[model samples]
Target chain A: MDMTTPLVEMREISIAFGGIKAVDHASVDLHAGEVVGLLGHNGAGKSTLIKILSGAYRADAGEIRIAGEPVAISSPRDAKRHGIETIYQTLALADNVDAAANIFLGRELLTAWGTLDDSAMEAETRKVMGRLNPHFRRFKEPVKALSGGQRQSVAIARAIYFNARVLIMDEPTAALGPAETKQVADLILELKKQGIGIFLISHDLHDVFDLADRVSVMKNGKVVGSAHVRDVTQDEVLGMIISGKCPPGAVAGPGALRS
Target chain B: MTESVPAPATPSQDAKSFADHLRAIEFDARMIGMIAALAVIWLGFNWLSGGAFLTPRNLWNLSVQTASVAVMACGMVLVIVTRNIDLSVGSMLGFVGMVTGLVQAQLLPGLLGFEHPATWLLSILAAVALGGLIGLFQGALIAYLAIPSFIVTLGGLLVWRGGAWWVTQGQTIAPMDSRFRPLGGGIEGAIGTSASWAIGLVICALIVAGIAFARRRRKRYGFALRPLWAEIVLAALACGTVVGAVAIANSYALPAGVARRLVEAKGGTWPEGGLTIGHGLAVPVLLALAVGVAMSFLARRLRFGRYVFSIGGNPEAAQLSGVNTRKVLMLVYGLMGMLVGIAACISTARLNAATNSAGQLDELYVIAAAVIGGTSLAGGVGTIAGAMLGALVMQSLQSGMVLIGVDTPLQNIVVGIVLVLAVWLDGLYRKRLG
Candidate 1:
């Protein structure tokens, strides 16, 4: 529970699919109130590594420790139980249902009669949504009708409402316009103020620079290098991603990221 | 959790402008379309039948005829909503009917020395359970084993139908226990005009209360709602339809043939003319309504229903949201199975016999009803009420065409065309909404 202990510590995770290595000996971690940016090109195995952490896939070899406590996350439920929440690119929403229903799909707030407590859920949704996106007003439409930013608000609201301490946002701003992306950035900054750690996966160098405190570059299912954002230029991080070589005189080097 | 959240939007806040009021109100557009379609179909058929179609006798018969399909269609809505189809339901019905018929007509007679009242109840329960068990088996294969629902149900269709035939060597089982007849709206199954009115009124009351509670919740959540007049109009419309249906059903008097037989059986002289209001509400129709209401509640008011729709809408998203998609799929199928059992009992009781082909081609009709009533074949969008109306529309078309003396082949051709047209219309409606 001490601030010095990283919020999440994943070690030497490896997973293979059909005799091909998707992720091999990769490690990533986040500290309290910090954003760890994971950057890699397609097929670089960054997503594969994150999926393992999100409990969508089990690593064939690895151990995950949260706040110095080893844990096994075999499913999305297990991930959530460990206070981890994922906002996938698809937003993972049921477009036919309104916001409140989508937010509480599996974990619905129920009345004494065991029926859905729609009012309570909606009130909570309104509270979280208002904080995440100040001008959001389409309360009745499904997440599909919401703009990219508004949809992100709903997803974030769901994750935050569940008291997520470790939030994984995958390409959240990828589809968003500049304004919406900025809105999401603001929301993430506010979340950081609450001491929640975020693992942000993005291809946009600008997003990484704007939000990340540390950048971890993955190439061919391995951590190319880890560096404090202030210590390495964007080109150096790009080099680490493309050639799997760490730049000289970097604050964070391979194996040196181990706490 | 933040001060950024605004004060609740009150009704008066948006009520100042009519367009604002209008824009704020969101209702199920598809449901309105269904009501309109059903009206047009009813009127068109009445016109085609030269008034015979709208008569109390024909209308009452249509309600009863729609029962089996409507009952199955309610469950089919849930099945279809969860991105699955149960093509074996028709065959399942035949299988269940065979089970019921075998027990009540053959096994019970032999075991108890004659058909007993309790035997009928026991047979009904067994038949429904068997239907559910069949559904669970198929659902498990699709959900847990990763087989497609189409394949599993398609195989079930053949296997269950063959099983039905195998059960009795294709010989018809007849003369169900006398007690079973009432449950199927046989001669003794009518609830009478007064009871029909009573039940309809009670339903109306419940519906109004439900609407009021919903409105209150919406207001509390600061969500926009339809105007008071709009709510009145919708409630009155529903209430009127129910009352009108009951009245029409009551107007059909027992024919002279039935009246004479009843008087003879009662050891009373038949008057020169005695009018007996046609049995008001067929028991099967009532049962269908009950099933429809219960299923509707489950689909709209419970966690299970929400999970089913979310899973159908987006399985990946549902899974990530921690929904147990496979379990929902299995339970949905299991529920569909139980409804099939109820439908089987109704079909058997109505036929007063169980034949191998008892529910021949009914899967097509049930699916057709669900699709036409607004359940999307693609899944994630459906309503039990709409499916029930869809059943009514299809049955009306079939019965009206038969009354018009259309050739059986031509009748099939017309239904096929109508199904295509209805689906096409649904697609267009969705596109327009988008």
Candidate 2:
């Protein structure tokens, strides 16, 4: 694959739920070591679009290319196998199990005797949590007992531990405090420095302005436009999100408002 | 924005209550509470029965009676943990028992000759396979077809019970194969004095070694360890219980007539004081314990067990995590069916007969045992050992009431009351913890 080939690409993805188009003819791409912010209102199909990429939902009509090679992602396991990871908006941690178990839910460590190597999992979890949240000490307690930020760290740790090439974080900072959100931003920069691509879904325009390399705005199940972060102001992205108006700096999509 | 990140504030740990101290030691309060409740029931029943309830003979009989329910209850823990129920277990047991009886009494006699060694094994395998298939069918409907488990298993309850009657045309099959009869636990089914003591000592050693191994593992990982005194105390308590049980089993002497017959058959005359033969441990009880251990291992150490709990906790999350939840659900039901099959074998062997009504209402007891043992109907929480103890508690209540000449209807009434009370107490405990 060439350097110009995007690390992840979704072309003309569409899905309908109960005859309503949740995501309609939308396309997005993320380059290696780049952060692409997905901005949209509550019902604007951003999450639905990302969910398709993460293999939580199969697109009705789409082509997903990884490093210029087309691939099929029919389930979450398929997504993980292709070096993709997602931190869902709901965090998606099993509340009854400890942090170590949640972190290694599908990919558990096993002993030579074919039993769960719980201590080994716990040791690894401690190493990850130490970097992600230093104050975290409840390794033995279930995730249900954790605070929102601590739970968010568990979800984040799960995503980053596997050396994911493409990370899709849906509202990563929604459940976190300001300090935790800042920590997430720093972590994202660190990951980008390591050449990992990120698709950041966020409502906070400031978050997009501060961290994203480029922004893609979706409105009413369609991508309004895409632009380099430095080329367009937050107001321009907001106009694209709220109305289907494409700014001069953005490349207009089929959903862009006609003048 | 500051580059340096501030440390998150820690929760206060100023005043530690007794419960906090217990938590520090990682003490399982629910397990201890169940044990205490069991003890109270035993002592209370013993007192009410004029000390007869705690005697070796009664206790031995109680253990044998509890074996079948305990076996099924182990599977029920997994079923309930995954937020599903198998109301057809009892009917399934009856159906499987009838089939096993037919195989051993009629079919096996012809194929393997009258007393062939393979007769018992083949019969049991057939029973288990049949039960598993039935369970899978119900599970498929619930998991793949999207039918609610309650409705599927409720349908199963009626269908399987009718199927059981259809198998024998409402007739009872009698006189199981001699080898198979040992599974039901009569004088022939007892392990006898020396073997019971040997097993008891081995279990004690295992208890001590398990604790030591765990401590060493925790130390290696730099995880917090329970106080050394607490560890020793716990080990001692567990070992004591095992040794005490062995002694009680050894104390339950066989009847003089049976002992005299054995001596005479051995070409020796009975002495003035007849020889004592201790009914050390029943075969069915051993089977139950083995099942308990295996189930506990599965729940705590296997990936399948983890997925079951994760699914129970949050099905959507488990699915998103790449767990094949439908397959897991199907297997869980299949496992439950297999346990019911084994339980059916035990019940049929013990009675030396299989009737359509053999295991009627047993589902209620099995579910009760799991629930009383602290398995949440809300799912994601339970233990095999706890359910086994719960079975023992239920058996004690029933046997004690019988010994005291309580009416059968009143016995059911008392059991119903206890089930509700146990669940209420468990709920209160969870609420307090929250």
Task: Name the lDDT of candidate 1.
Answer: 0.85
User: lDDT values of the candidates?
Assistant: 0.85, 0.92
Best by TM-score: 2
lDDT of 1 by residue, B162-251 (tens): 999999899999978888877778557787778988998998998799889889988987766788888888788888888888888777
TM-score per candidate: 0.93, 0.97
Give lDDT: candidate 1, residue A69.
Answer: 97
lDDT of 2 at B369: 96
C-alpha lDDT (0 to 100) for residue B289 of candidate 2: 93
- Listed for each candidate, the true contacts retained, as a fraction, are 0.53, 0.50
Q: Name the weakest run of 10 consecutive residues (lDDT summed) in model 1 chain A.
A: A250-259
Q: Which stretches of candidate 2 lie over 4 Å from their true place?
A: A1-3, B1-15
